[model samples]
Target: MDRRHKPSNILPPGEKLPAATVDIDEKRQTVSATLPNGDTVEVLLYGATVTSWKNGGGKTENVWVSEKAIWDGSKPVRGGIPIVFPNFGPPIKDHATSALPQHGFARNVRWEFLGSEKSESGTSSVKLDFGLYSSALPAKFREAWPLDFGLVYSVTLSEEGLRTIMTVRNEGSSAFEFQFLLHTYLRVNDISQTTINGLGSETYIDKVLNATKHEQTTPSLSITGEVDRAYIGVKQDTTSVLEGGSPRFDVIRDNLSDTVVWNPWIEKAKGMGDFAPQDGYKNMLCVEVGAIDGWQKLEGGDAWEGGQLIKSLL
Candidate 1:
């Protein structure tokens, strides 16, 4: 069984909320970080998954974690930023696929809370780090994927929005390859009314149509049904403004090379146990930033860093 917050966990000295005395709530093993101006960001200890990111002086939320999202440490949280490492999806071959879990095991394990510090952004913000290393893994987990690695992830919460930065370091004697993604789920009033900009004219592999090559014609993408497309080699940064809502998601990627736009419509939602309220599809959109089409080959002792910053326009 997993350990809950104890006296030794050493909680942070966080800002106060409107009525509550404490802003950092670890009651449910979740850390509620607040900016000096009242912006709040909640992260779960299970996956270091940021469940909610609300801007200051506004009730509107940017990050969307499913209402039915699992919190028992049994599986990955349904929404928010599910960090995809080592593997993006299932492997093609039979035997090779059994070695790793879908989207990798990083999201399913407990990350060490490295405490918080005043962010360097010069705003009313705080940044915290969570890390995972092969030395901290259980013996059984190590037997599955023997690569020795370390991952350090940081979340910076500001009145403007939330920014996540990840750095992966190779600790072993041999070179290793890995893929990465910040599987971000943004909340929207209605999916059909949301127009995703920046990748409209790009090239993509449509997973909904069996990975067929496609060239997006328009400058903004509108979703009507089940859609899953992997757009690789994205050249420009994007500010995806969900016009129906004012929370413009300005996704800036550095060293991150791909984008995955997906929405599991009605039918698929019903089939998923993690995503309940079948109609919930209309309220969420996953615009993930990743290096999916290719892998990052890191030599021993080499480290790679990449991240995405989601800032609100409104």
Candidate 2:
């Protein structure tokens, strides 16, 4: 860890945070950090505002982060975790105009490293939590769709991979609507070589059109072009597996009933300048776990939470 970085034992006992921490390789414009177990996760803060998590051998690195989710951010630069909120797709002028920071501000603003700890399964991990509220927003946000809300984003760095959990709590009156997703960009050895399993019998929502319908009646997806679609009304008894075989990863989400699988492929990648190595499609895939379709309406006293646990069986 850098001598200048703040040191904190954010994890539970038995698991110590690596003294080696996150630092901006200014010359490279990349943020790199070594975990307590001697592993590393890097973030290329160009268009993708959040960290680009990479393991030792470098499997999957480019994934989206969605909290209060949206796709609008500093254009040309789009990757990382975009906290989409209040609503998902195109901005609805009346309902969720305030959610228009484009992907929300979670990605744009930096997060605080709280601590590290061992989850129930006893894996060593670092827990980073970020919160956003109306009180934290500017006057402009307060003028838009006004609501008292707080988002708790916890990113856990485990030996296997990163486990992210987001808790959305409504802090104000008047039931409001919103959406949530963990737009994870997974690294792969070859796109053509990968075939995600476990979604064989599930249905998915197609985002290419406004018609809220699912196309996975057959329950299987093979990526072709820009794979931008949402899978909804899923049962908790489902398992989503992502792999090209040998180096495989299975994602299990508790309390989340939706999944989004995406990849910009060649054309979309070329359009984004920050996404250098545009040909990197062969190495990444975006499988987002989310709550889309109808906006989730939460009363002031209610709370909504979901999580993604990625385990690698290499």
Candidate 3:
């Protein structure tokens, strides 16, 4: 074995060591990292999506992915963390993003691998960066929304949890407005036993109810049927997903004001071609964090940043 890989007891005190080992599969267009503590994270260049995250000596998987999800870059991965940019859901007619497809093109295009950096704080952590520029977009997407912008997404993994941050910069002379979201799919043993906390007093827009607005009455929201609600202006930055009264995951957001809780349930789950096993809906929940309730306007030469930290409590 390499000397650096030897047991820590044989090394001198206070000596700096590598935090994690990263592997780049150029043919597959994927990057994976393994920390000394056995925590691991994997990212795909397509959409710069985080496809897998495992903690607790690699025995616990906190992120969810569909078995039938296409990996040929044909479509966005059904699960994991999909980036929503410039638009969310379907685009409004006659709007700036009207010509763009549903949820914009951020999750559809390929991103460049910027690189990876090990934490200098002497902690067992690593950060991977990916970049997407306006010039890198396909002709159809570039023509649909002719705005010069650049996005830098960073995914940091540590022994405690995983953190993802995105920086959006306007490279054009004209100002533009856009919507951004992190569609995070979390894994659970059973959706019926899962409850989301910290959204009790907030008001939300229920897309399933014909876009009706209502206040949340349940302190611990449980998924019984189809749900597609966007809780707006959430005051709490921290939300917890509990499985059978035990906290399974804690999501801490920064600069993200809206939270969308969704579960396709029975029929809707079957409708999605990429969703696997037909019953995959019962094993996952989307606790998406975003700023989709309103547009974020950025002037020329300005930049905006936001992110979230998802910690596994299981």
Candidate 4:
């Protein structure tokens, strides 16, 4: 940990504070942020993937990290919030594309820890900053893309909710286009009882239905089968509630124009090698906040920022 990046609030033994702490986890490479208000968030240095967010106020866990998730630093973690950058899936045009790998390397590559900070309004918040630069990337990776860029990822935790923001700057003289998404796997007691609201008449491209465009029929979404849709033009904020469990989650976001609602039902769950429990699909839902179905173009010296905040609702 960098000495200059120390947290602001320090509490003694037996004392409690509305402060935040940034520490390397017992696992060695992971980082954790625990707020004084019972809000906690955890992330791995590899992929900068957020693996946990437990609400202390309700003593409830909101994130659904896969038990069989790979932690050997070989592949992207199966659950939690995986940052998708440069490309949402595979590269569309090989060398012309972002040299994509599934969801780009943002969630599969190692990141540099810049530091941590704490802030307060009526409520307190803690934030950790990470950086990913083209210079730090592998030689072949740069050779393939040859575009210089920098990414600053901020994960903030507060009594209100958890927010993860990604800011990408064009360090090179040329322009680049990329697709992004926060592959958030939310924990739920039962998928059948979970319903995501706020996309009533929005248009979505159903990947399972031959990529056709259609407006949402219902105001509330109930997942029963495999769902792979990119809801474009989400002009307003969203609210997803889990009625099957106590301390329901309110997933919120801003400046994210797309909502990817997905669930790999029984058959799809059993086919995934990284997802554990085989039937774990029934316990989770992915209401991903994203800028998918379109590309964000950034010219030289330009930047783009977007984030989502998640909190528990009792």
**Candidate of highest TM-score:** 3
Better of 1 and 2 by lDDT: 1
In order, what lDDT does every prediction score?
0.78, 0.59, 0.89, 0.79
TM-score per prediction, in order, is 0.88, 0.75, 0.94, 0.90
C-alpha lDDT (0 to 100) for residue 211 of candidate 4: 87
lDDT of 3 by residue, 1-314 (tens): 23211112212345576668899998888999998878999999999999999999888898889999877799999899999998999999878999999999999989998988875445677889999999989999999999999999989888668888888999999899999999999999999999999999899999999999999998889999999999999989888999999999998887778999999999999999888879999999999989898789999999988878899996
Arrange candidates by lDDT, descending.
Answer: 3, 4, 1, 2
Model 2 spans > 4 angstroms off: 1-33, 42-50, 56-77, 98-105, 110-123, 209-214, 217-219, 236-242
Judged by lDDT, which candidate is best? Answer: 3
Across residues 115-212, which tens digit of lDDT does each residue of candidate 4 receive? 89776344567788889999988776677667889999988877767878888999989998888899998888888887777788889999889989
Query: Which of candidates 2 and 4 reaches a greater lDDT?
Result: 4
Q: Residue by residue across 195-261, what tens digits does model 1's lDDT show? A: 8888867899999998899999998888988999999898776647566655467777766779999
TM-score of 1: 0.88
Residue 291 lDDT in candidate 4: 85
Angstrom error at residue 35, model 3: 0.6
Better structure of 3 and 4 per TM-score: 3
Number of clashing residue pairs, candidate 1: 0
The digit string of per-residue lDDT tens for model 2 on 1-314 reads 22221222444456333354555565655555556556556544332234556565454443533222233433323445444555565665555654465544445443334333334323445555555666766666566657788777666666756666777888887777887766666666677877666566566666565546655654556676666766677664335444555546677765667777777788977876567576777677777677776778889878887767776555
Residue ranges of candidate 4 with Cα displaced over 4 Å: 1-18, 120-122, 244-247
